[model samples]
Target: MTTNNPMRTFDDSRRWATDGTAMLTTAIEQLDASGIAAGSQLPGWTRKHVVGHVAANADALGNLISWAETGIEKRMYASTEQRNADIERAATLPADELLTWYARGATALEGAFDRLTPQQWQHEVITAQGVTRQASDVPWMRAREVFVHAVDLGTGLGFADLPDDFLTALADEIRVKRGLSEDDLRAVSGSLPDVTAWLAGRPHGIADAPELGPWL
Candidate 1:
C-alpha cells in the first residue's frame, strides 16, 4: 500500500529534525530547575509538560522506526490514555532526570534513524493520529514536534526564528490542515510568521486575526 502523509517525501526531514533537537537542547539547557514549573505558550501546560511530551514523543516515534525496521506493526503509543499518562509521569521527574530522558530519547531516535536501511524507509507505518505514512516521514514528524514545542516552552523563540525551509513547509502543511487555499493563506493580514501562527491557532499578536483552528 502507498503512504499518503504529505511529508513522506521531504528529504530534508532528517536534517531538520536534527536541527530541531539541537534547538530544543539549547533552550532546555537555558532553563533552570524552576523553569519547568512556569507556564508555556500552550495554554494549561507548563514547561514541564512540554518537555515531558518531547521526551515521550521520541520514544513513541521510536516504535514507528522499529515497525519500519522489522515490517511489524508497532503503534506509536500503546493507547491514547497510556500516551497522556506517560507524558504526565515524565513531567513529574526531577529536573536532571527529565533532562536526561530528553537527551537519551533523542539519541536513541537518531540512532534508529542511522540504522534504517534505504528499503526500510519506504515501509508503511501508522502515526499517532492513525494516518498511514512512510517511515521516511518519521523525522519530519519529529521535526514538527521539537521545533514547535520549543517555541511553546516560552523560551523567546518563535516561528519567525525557524529555518526558512521549515517555516515555508509548515505554512503549507498548516494551510492544508486548515483547509485553506493558497489565495486564502495569502489573504491573511500579517507577516509570514504571524500568519502561520494564526493558521496554527496560536496567538498571532494581530489585532483581529481570524482564529483558524487549533494546532495540528
Candidate 2:
C-alpha cells in the first residue's frame, strides 16, 4: 500500500526503537506507588493506564514481528474489546509487577526484531489500523508508541528528549492524518519537540490554538 513515508532503513528504525524504549523504561522505573496512580495528561487515563497500554502495545506489535518471521498471520489482537480488556487487566497490577510486565513485553518484541533477516524487513504486515506496511515499520511504530506514551505518563519527560527527525516526521504525519495544513491553523511557533507534541495532542507549553485530538 502507498504511504507518505520515504524509504527507511532497518538500522535507523532499530536505533530509534532502542533509544525510545530506553527513555520509556527510565520514565516507567521512576514512577512510585502514588506516581503511577496519579492522573496523566490523557484525560481519564491514569499513569497506570498509559503504562498498561504501552505494555500491551508491545505484545500486539510483537505479534506482527512474529508474522513477518514465520509468514503466519498473527493478528495484533483478537479483537478491539479483547485489546481493551487486556490493558485493563494490566492496569490493575501493582507497580513492580507492572514494570516487569512492561519490560518483558518490550524485550520480547525486540527479540523478534533481532531475529529478522534483511529480506524479512521488507515483508508486508498489517497494522492494527488495518494498513499494510513493511516489517521495517514495526520498530518505528513501537518507537512512536513508547516515546509519545512516555510523555503522556505526565512525568517530567517531554518531547524534547525525542530525536529531531522523529519530531519532524511526526509533525508531518499528524498534519496529514488530522487534515491540517499550515494555512488551516495559526502560524504556531515552538521547538520541534513542542510542536510535535502539540500536534500529537499531547500537552505542550506552546502557543494556543484549537484543541487537536485523540492522537495515538
Candidate 3:
C-alpha cells in the first residue's frame, strides 16, 4: 500500500517486504566496522539495538501470520516485559551475530508470509499494543520497521529517499494513528516528506512547532 513504485496487487506488498529487508541489510552492511555500535536516532538505542528489535519484531509478526494461517490465537509477544527483555538481551550481541539474527528472523517470517492464501491474508490478529488488524498488514509493518530503522541507523536514508508511495501511505497512517484532525495536519507544511518526517517525530526542524511525543 506504499512507495513510489507502482504496486498493483497484494503480490506487490510481498515484493516490497522483501525489498525493504534487502534495503536494511545493505545499510547495515555498509556501516563502518564501528558504525553498528554508534547511536541511532532513537534514544539510548545503538544501531545494534534497532536492528535487533527489528529482528525480534519479524518473528513476532510471524506469530500473527501463523495465527491467520491456522485460526489459532497467537499473541505477538508472550508479554510486554518479556519483549523488552528480549530486545535488551539481543542488543548485547556482536555485530556479525546481530546480522545473523536479522537474517534468520526475517527469512523465517518471509517464508511464513509466502505460504498464506489470499483469504488468510484477511484474517484478523492483534498487535502487541492490542490493536487488531489484517494479517496482510504484517508485511507492511515489517517494511516500516526496516525502512524507518534504516534511517534511524543515522547513517543516511531519509524519508525522501524511501519509495514515494511508501511515504504517502506512512504519512496517512500516522495521521490516523495519532488521532490527528484536519487542523493537526494543517499545522505542518503540505510537503509529503516534511509532513511524514514531522509526524514520525523525526527531527524535521518544524519551526516553533509544538513538541510531539514519540511516534511509531
Overall lDDT per candidate, in order of appearance: 0.85, 0.83, 0.82
Stretches > 4 Å off in candidate 3: 1-12
* RMSD, every candidate, angstroms: 2.2, 2.3, 3.2
Give the alpha carbon lDDT tens digit for every residue of 58-159 in model 2: 999999988989999898989999999988887788988988889999999989888988888778999988999888888889888988887888888889
* TM-scores of all candidate predictions against the true structure: 0.94, 0.92, 0.90
lDDT by residue for model 1 (18-39), tens: 9999999999999999987788
Clashing pairs in 1: none
- TM-score, cand. 3: 0.90
lDDT (C-alpha) at residue 200 in model 2: 89
Ranking by lDDT: 1, 2, 3
- Candidate 3 per-residue lDDT, tens place, 47-139, comes to 888888998999899999999999999999999899898889877888888888889998999899889988898888999889888887788
Quote the positional error of residue 148 for candidate 3 in Å: 1.0
- The residue ranges of model 1 lying beyond 4 angstroms of the native Cα positions read 1-9
